[model samples]
Target chain A: MSYLQLSLYSETLRLETNVQVILAADPAASPCLLLLHGASDNDTIWARWTSIERYANRYGISVVMPGAHLSAFADMRRGPAYETFLMRELPEFLHRHLGLPTARELNLIAGLSMGGYGALRLGLRHPERFSAIGCFSSGNLLVATGFIPGTSDPYGWISLVMGEDINNPALAGNPDFDLFEILAALHADAPLPRVYMACGRDDFLLNCSRMTAERLAAHPALPFYYEESHGAHDWNFWDRYVKHFLDWYTDTEKTLTETTTD
Target chain B: MANIIFHSLSPALHTQRRLRVILPDSRRNDTNLPWLLLLHGAGADGSRWLRMTRAEYYAEAKGIALVLPDGDNGYYTDMRHGYKYYTYLSEDVEADVLRNFPSLSRDPQRRYVAGFEIGGFGALKYALDFPDHFRAAGSFAGGLDPQSLDPDYCVLTFGSYKQAWQAENDLFNRLRTALTDDTRLPDLYISRREQDYLYTVPDRDFASDNAMTSGHTIKVSRFDFNSADPWSFADRSLAWFLDRICPDRAQLFTPPAAADCPDDCHTDCSDDSLADCPTGKPTKE
Candidate 1:
């Protein structure tokens, strides 16, 4: 459960950035978790707010936490190349620099709030890279208009990211802002990531999680697990559900998908 | 400057150890930039270096990478009754660091080791035992002679005093064996706070061996600075260390020297004793 706070140069951003990397003992053989943080925090928040280390230590999985700032982990129409950094450059850096495993079956992507949206987006967009996806109280970009209370931007800050042409891809290989659009784009028979979504009963983003769950229910071919618990858009709920997600994730094993590593 | 702290399980000790690395932004692009591994004292861990000194400030200006690892109370050795820390450092931690920062130089001449107090002993011992691993070694108030160290430390670390273990761990003995080869030896930089007698003059044998070892650089300096604050002295020790290993780096920041203090008589820092001092404390290094 040892962690390293690294400030490395990001070639994609053309600037130096920081990432908190926590690896289980014998990381070479352990599975990896790309843990993301909420909008209001940086890379250190997860470890600062919860006993993620203790939990990951018990589960024997390595965790990598990166700061996505305010972006929706997308190749922002008006922002930096976060999607390129997170989806491609980051994992490549981990595998090349830290020697952490990079196989699809050996990786899990999870996050909360805006970060939950990030996990769901990246995991869904690149199912070839991860085995399971854990998202808690995800911010539903399924919106057409109006504000999502918890975020700084009213109509999702996502509009700013997607720009005027929401359907137009900002970066090559980037999916459209709408989660339904990304899902519809995915072939049903294509290998899907094992998905887990949980939301607090009192959470503002409960609708986001619910809508996603309902949509997944329609796609019975997708291995999705949904749950609503006595909890909100808070750390207490996330603290508990994150552990629950890890438990569910570890308990169920996914078949190895098509191979891709750099 | 970037502060990178990492933890990894040590197969040698069967436990986890923490290490902090300070890399200068200028050297971030240089794949073969020099590196220095600094060890901490008995009670403190790797973070103490940052807490006690502005190490990153100097590292940034000097264009050299600094590494600090928690040696714990084992004195950076494979303890007779405790963990195999030496093996953990040599076999496990070093390799992990290289992988984490591929920009660091793998050449032994570009690598360095130094320590504070007990860490000073560890630094010299490492340089001695693994001459091909470091280019230079430094010691600040080094416990060079373990027999002269606290009896408790001796028993806890080696199980007895004046025994073969003491002789085996002696820096003088190591200097003889490890420095015999002129071709594969790291230069030495030894310093002490003038009041702290942790390192007196080296014994005759050590002096003779160092004199005969004409192929390498060896320097000794004593600075009158406050040890309680640690950085008051450690900051200077770092500069002097660089002065030997990388002279160009030593020129980056030159602290106020003896000439800066006209009444430089306050070796011990205290209210009444400070009456003899101009700045009301030991001279700032």
Candidate 2:
């Protein structure tokens, strides 16, 4: 597998975002995984996992790890550029520079910690873009309403993104931010991508993961998979968890491969 | 002749959770039709069928209208946290589709449901769980029983075995019962690829032998394709199955063959040669 380190200016954020990208082969190969980094960290954070190479080689997919500062994947007041850069600019750059494929089999978004939140957020908002989504050790910012102080809003992060006051009832609790509710509604309308999420049993975020899992249990369409191991929020757990996600991703890719070109 | 119309719902949200409707097109607004709800597997949204498979074309060609619903990574379930996904897809989404699109036949025979991969499993589970809802059902390389799904994979899907099973065991047990019974399941078409890694030997075996022996009209087709490529698999099998079982959709069945194909399997390769690509080198043009 060949890996490339590239830096691109975020027209959305009006800043530069550095990314560590891995390509299984030249652009002739199928497009695979897109790895987005979590808060306070850059794309290199995923380098510590053994699963990165394993996934790149095993599935023959490329991984794009973007480095973004903390703020839980939010662009902060700097501009909603992080989401814009990821949803729009990143794909354009990859396709222009690396000759990646677009549409089905194009890209899957995944991340750990803050990156996980980003992955879920992106998947929820732009379901058409990604084939699959994996989240690791992150808060369910969508549903973290009461957990955060002085908020009656149902769509926690969504209100934040839309700049709506939490007290606004008309659209405040709108199901946009609550990813789990989005899944429930989406399952009724269409089938969603495979969801893979995990956290250590003792991790502080375990309850959040559990809450997400419990909600997923009701809908037959959403196959939200989860796991709790005896670990914490540190890299050791993420390393193992990421490997598990990669394995499933490879398996899903293999299962999805119904037709192969000559 | 478009039987179904595709609409973008939840546009206000950052993500595009689209809904495809199989209703009477403007030309056929006077006529009644049957509606089949189709769900896509993981890594995909509602557009997987309309955009990639051109299922809308098939729906237009046939009288049956197919609806594709978008489920984000939430796995088509209601969230434990607070999201009501289950209600949204089955109830709210259904209401929205019915209200927005022309009415299809209300007959159960016309009410079909199916999906691929995660969608596939969900389709089967939904049909079995609500046996009276759909007349025919299909799932391609679906993760059928989450609890029975491979532990390694299941753990990743739910984040833990306890949670995965706790949430999905009822469905698993119900499916297990259906596999053992002679009735109570829909006319099922379950399939998988020869090399799929997720729906392993156990899943295939269960779907083929047990799921069938229990009395449901279960037909499992093992294809010679890459299990990892959901789009290709769905485009072919979905078109084929929908045409056959839902003969009301005969027009969607365009013959597709896997031939002279490039090696479109792996994205990463140890071999540097472009010759390895099934599609050959991507043209700069």
Candidate 3:
């Protein structure tokens, strides 16, 4: 495996940011997976906590892990323009510099926690960009704009990421920001990216995942899969399910060799 | 700005290690710039310092080289049952970084360590364990007491929460002994959010103990924030770091360089062929 730590100047975010790229040995013909990290996390979590490198090498695929910080994968109201950087600039950099494929058939996106929300949001908004999208313990489908009963301010933490405009009618219904609205706006005939969703039964965000699955299921033309397992909203769950999701996404013939030992 | 580098055959962990090194853009040739070993929290790696905070921007003018290395959820310890991250941080990583970056200062007085959460614990532990190697240490919302950690995580890290494990790994126990002999110890800076669920009690205890200790060098700063804001912690930590480590320095006050838009423009360039433009601009020919 070859790991490349790239420090690229992000025009969208207007800063020099870090991206961790892991390439399978002899990756000339390998596909690429754009792995997104959760809130307060950078690209390193995937490499540190998960068996991402081994999996990438086993599947002969490359992984691009970008650091979006607390931007929640959104073009932040108060911070960096992460949405534009991740959705556009990063992919372009990979395709140009590393000779990775830019076509939807060879590109995939998956993430856990806040990154799960980002993967789904980016994939749905730019459906033509990726072949499939996997979300683990995602809260993107949850409606979080209103006030919590005990919190001092009703808007709560969601207001930090989505902004106070989340209450505005036009922004509230905007398909680009809301998953349900995005599902509603999807044309029946429009080619949709394959969707895979999973959450731990014990995860706080399990209901959010279920809601997302329900919405995805409503679209008969969309190819969607959902799974629930015994786990929590932790790295253990992500480590297990990320492997499963990758197995489902990749060709079975090229699966990790059974002889390979950890 | 940021340089991604790898160290193969790391003796401490028996694995290849990757780190992101952020150096002052203007001090490439200077060999004695102050160094800060920035550690990442649980489930994070070397990229977090550069990615999650304006650390690189803050360090750029201060002429400090920020070294961020992968800790692999090891809690920055020589885990009783897991990886030896403590050795990696103190011996392997420090040696590797110095070997690679000659411009970074070699003096212990010019080197510092800081981190957030678990990384913060690592920083405190590193400074305590290797008092002669670092001049100052800062912990932002650190998990100071290993016994207070989640049982499952504690078990994985310390083999068992047995008396022996606590004796060997607990920060409080180490501090109690180290505080008696203050010679060579790094000046400690600990900050926590007012509402932090995990570190409030321990932080307060540490602060009180430091206050009671004669010839005290520890400084505890508390901030008010709903839940925890890493950005606020980072901002305060940088200010604290500058005040104690390089006080009243004119260069440290310089603002970050303006966004170089030319490098950013190629991200959204319309031409599909130009999408791979390496120069951050469209190909003219």
Candidate 4:
């Protein structure tokens, strides 16, 4: 278990910010999981989970965590876009500080809550780079509360990202400016990536997750694997659900063998 | 000599996108070296990896040169309205690597592609779609199948199934089948935070199931850290993987050179230890 903390000048942000990372380098492993945290929390939150330790040993896998607290990992007009910072700036710092391989199959992203939302957004928004993704207890953006005064509204902390309100209304900088709309458009236009999600039944935001599930269900063209369990929005449920997802992903490889044989 | 010749994206490229090159140091500039092209996710540019991790330094030290290309919001793909990005990164970017950098290996084994977030998708997509381009690959927090797994995000981002149908058509099935079919796959490494906020149960399960059922050379890790600060996790995990697949590149093993150390600091400094160089040492003066 090694931890690397880095602070650097981001050409994207044009400011100096700090990035925290942790890794379990396993030489025997092939693909490395690069997990991103949700809004408000830091990297340590994931460290608190005992399953992480078990998964590391159980699968001979390694982990990479990047810190993006409060900031929505958005590229904005106000400050250096956090999205860019995490996607590009942060990786630079990690490559130098830690001895990680540079390849396509070696990286993956997963998150919870807001981070889960970001995961789905970022993953489909860019399908070529990531082969797979996992999102747990995500907030559905299509819902009305998706964008409030401070949470995602540009006027709040995210203002830097959305910029001054655009007159077009259609092109407003609001992060939630119809995220659902964008996804619908892309689904119609391009090849959306393979995505998976799990939510607890008792979770307060279960409706949001349910709505999300329903929207995709309408799309016969989309091929997504999903599951809903009896739990809540708390970390405990998220923890158990994430482990299950990992287990399923581990088992998905057998399909390839079957496909080849068939 | 291995050297990094950076090409600032011209105004057109910059406004349209950002691109940078990290070549081997002058000492490794002989035949073509192996090339590692990184694609960043979402709002990030080519320089993202440089900022997040000391990738350029490691690449320089490791003898593996890097090509960082901006993906913008295109997800490393060619979006609507003539966003020729998918071609830019896969075809044009490779062309540039072959022409300008000696670090690019003619052998596919020496070539690799990788990214974080959206870039993760780009890395995997490039490798999966273009299997001959690179021998191995990686994705950090990349997206898998959202249509079924994450409907809320799906509707929010894409609006309706009618609209998302085109982009999502057969994507999951293809990937599911592809992961299960190992004959044409690159070495893959997938990781996530145990308590991650995104890519919940379904996304994680999709990848995991593929790995478990398909016999794909897929690896998984749930680190103790979150995705926001995944530098350390990515560094350790990626380094471990690279060392195994592309071991000949010595620069990967070498650490970044001290920026503050002057030429004579190594000789004039009293501290003999590598960490004791004037620039390396902690000093009030």
- Compared with the true structure, what per-residue lDDT tens digits does model 3 show for residues B1-285? 756566444677654456667778768788787888988776556766666667777787566788888776678887654457888888898788767778778898889999887888889878877888888999877877676677866765776667424655667667766777655678887766555654335553655645445565776555444344555556555655655666645333222223533645435422212223355332221
State the TM-score for model 3. Answer: 0.50
Provide the overall lDDT of each model, using Cα atoms, as 2-decimal numbers.
0.71, 0.61, 0.71, 0.57
Backbone clashes, candidate 1? 0
Identify the leading candidate in terms of lDDT.
1
Q: Report DockQ per prediction, comma-separated.
A: 0.02, 0.02, 0.02, 0.01
Candidate 1, chain B, TM-score (2 decimals): 0.81
The sequence of per-residue lDDT tens digits that candidate 2 reaches over residues B183-271 is 56678776566555533555435554555446666665544465455577776667667666756434554332334334456533222
lDDT of 1 by residue, B1-285 (tens): 888877665556544455788888987678887888887775666777777677777777678888887666676777544456677667777888777878778998889889888788888877877888987889876767666666755654676776524654777766765555655677878776767544345452353545445566565566675646765677677766765666665464354465555464544332112224455443344
Give the winner by lDDT: 1 or 4.
1
Assess candidate 2 and give its lDDT: 0.61
What digit string (tens of lDDT, one per residue) describes model 1 on residues A1-262?
Answer: 6889876657775434568888889887899999988764667778877778877887889999987656667776544578999888988888888889988888999999878888888887888888899988884554522343333433225344655433432332234666766776777767789999998999877776787778866776778899898887788887788788988998855322222211
lDDT (C-alpha) at residue B210 in model 4: 45
Choose the strongest candidate by TM-score. 3
What does the lDDT read for residue B12 in candidate 3? 74
Q: What is the DockQ score, from 0 to 1, of model 4?
A: 0.01
